[model samples]
Target: MRSSTIRRALAAASTVSMLALSVSACSEDTANDSTVDFGYIGDYNGVSLLAIAKKLGLWKEVGLTAKVKAFNDGPIQVQALRAGNLDFGYIGPGAMWLPASGKAKVVAVNTLAYADRVIAQPGITSMKDLKGKKVGVPEGTSGDMALNLALEKAGMTAKDVQKVPMAPATIVSAFSSGRIDGAGIWYPLIDTIKAKVPDLEEVASTRETDSSFPTAFVAGNKVKPELTSKVIKVLQKANDWRARHPREAITESARMLELDESKVKADAANVETLPTADLVAKTKDGTVDKWLNVLGDFFVRNGQLESAPDPSSYYTGDLYTKAYAK
Candidate 1:
């Protein structure tokens, strides 16, 4: 066989073997019933709410044996969900646009407000100052996309600056060595980097942006849509817990994420946790549709997508409505 053909055959064989192994490990009961495997981009503050959900057994209470896994970033997490390795995960608006166009359906908007920021060395005041300066970003992540958006808002692009693609964990070392002028990342790392550099300045925050960026709970398109209701229920329970017991939620999340309580509290405050009912109403009323269309258009105008897909099909408010109605 041709080399390309041989490689394709090997990949197919590997996939089959993995599927067979997964099937073999399933009990008769579990073989028929569905299980949801949730994925998220790693970083204590980014997934602090998820940590609280898991710690409080919210998923179990909602009839899901939720297997939450950590990924490097949103792009990777979405890819895993697309491949059937994960049932659901959180994804930023940018990453969600691409997959939602394909076969991934967003079930609920996790957060609407921007909860991220672009932090740079003290002396770097603006995107213009970042020109010719090395910047570290978790490539293909929401953070990287956010950085691109910041640059665009400042009338620049990635080509206007030196780009260094690194994982979030390694950004601190890169910053300390003076190898990077800035790092676009989320909290906890933002907190850590600030402590290490003391004089680091935030150039932009999601809070200041004009867009309502939607980070969502997504599931594979092929999965039974009914399971989405279970996922929404779990999320609703978690959100309700947050409102009723903010301190306990913060404490449990901090312990689970191994971060200081104050940082966790700060991160929690930044998140706009929505109940499934509100999300369903908002989505049905075209709130999320409007945002997704705007974001899609932004990507297309900037040449991100070949053509924009219909935002309506990208999300279904049905699951949220059903889950929250109960």
Candidate 2:
């Protein structure tokens, strides 16, 4: 990730940034169609194939000149996708509503291996203690999901607290200054904040429910349609390289987030990167289908979507099949 991009890792979530997937001329093929405008969340967990593909020069060899942008939040990325300013995106549950709402599609997915953790201020020791306190979370992101889960585990909900909306990168500042009492976020960013305040301690992690939160690489419904298959091929090649060179993959991902190697390595172990064929099989056999249903139901119950569409319709394995053709 670019240092400038990493610097804003915690920008607050924006309510103004709707998915806005209205048909626009922006998702059209550009003059230089070989270039793919890929925007991804800079969170290290989502860095798996994109950063490695760049480091290995895999995308270029696969006939793509990627124009990468790192956004601090996913909804904003959807905003760009809506305007046709982006071709491909790696988004998390925070923005999965796009695909679930027929605005985009999931071309690939990442394992729920990397779950989120909660860091509490010294005075607040456990999830139960967060009642009525001000807590920071970027709304709709995985961190928020984890926070909600943890709160429920403690017999509370969003209604029980003053939910301060802010990016994980910015949470530490507020926390130390006493603006917020705790923060729920992903690994490195959570760790980054902890480094600044050693007295703060970890209280809860969403490991028990990690399997329910798979990360997805989504494409706008009308994205550079022709290159979608090519993009998936390169992603597969990158993941193959990662399995063969686990340490190197971890190191490369760490470099992108500018985080400690061990932190990335620890998180990497939890995230199971699935192969294309298996993901395709799962997608078709209702394994992936069931997961999407659960997610859509959760989002709707939580008031994110009005009605859930057929989750299976949002993905297709045809590209994966053709990508491996003889």
Candidate 3:
């Protein structure tokens, strides 16, 4: 009787252990299905729309629980995505070549033009006058790329000018101390500099030069493919909200960026937000393709990218199609 009772207890313990393992497996699967992480490049003019989306609950409206993280620059953002630290974020079009050559994928073009501006000190009049003068640029950035492109267009190169690598934060000081003759930067910083420097002149704008250069929304190649559509929905909703509420968007963005409202408004006027879903249609119809191809080839010739990437590899239309179609 004693032996039989011990056998029964051991059998019951084994059964309970198996049941616990099954439950643990199910729990693990459920947890894996629920979370997503997203990353965005650090402060820039284009980030305002994304800020409005977060403030207005657009991400929640689209049923995405995103962990929005910020990085110092687009190149860093690309590195994060490559390391599986991000689900999606905005990146410079020129920087996209790094990931396109590897495992990352670009889902859509967020901004279709370079909207940055070159602001110079009072006495600096034109691009010609900029020669031999010190210029400040955020190294390895879109602003840097634009400045380089502008120089090339003027029959000059980086070697012709003294290019000073400075952070956007240090630009004002660099200019004030006569360390740099001009600064190439985007909004908030541009507006801030203008307000601080009474004698600043608007030399050239990125929008004025490369109107077709593509800024993008990129995702990790390993993310669940189905989530791509959801990501588009979030971006489109944010963009639409920005369009409808420009003032509010500006105010909110200004608040987040800690800039003057008028300055924010002035900068906002120069930006044109492109719909993420429209990128593919625009490309297939020869609009985006032509523009991106031109910019790509330009960059290649200027030594930005090793070669012009295949247009299809640089953009994915299916996600946009599904998001808009829904």
Give the best candidate by TM-score: 2
Ranking by TM-score: 2, 1, 3
lDDT of each: 0.64, 0.67, 0.60
Residue lDDT tens for model 2, 1-326: 00023322433221222122111223234455667777766545567677788787776565557777777656666777778988887776656766787777788775554457777889778887887888898776777777876776777778988888886566757876767888777664654566667788677876755346677777877865567887888777887777778899888877765666776676676566666667767766778777777778777866778977787678655665567552
Model 3 residue 68 CA deviation in Å: 1.8
Pairs clashing within candidate 1: none
lDDT tens readout by residue for model 1, 91-141: 665576556467588777776545567778888888788888888987655
Q: State every prediction's TM-score relative to the real structure.
A: 0.83, 0.84, 0.79
Error of 1 at 17 (Å): 23
Q: How many clashes does each candidate structure show, in the order listed? A: 0, 2, 0
**How much does each candidate deviate from the true structure in C-alpha RMSD?**
8.5, 5.8, 15.6
lDDT of model 2 at residue 56?
Answer: 78
Off by more than 4 A, model 3? 1-30, 41-45, 93-103, 258-260, 275-280
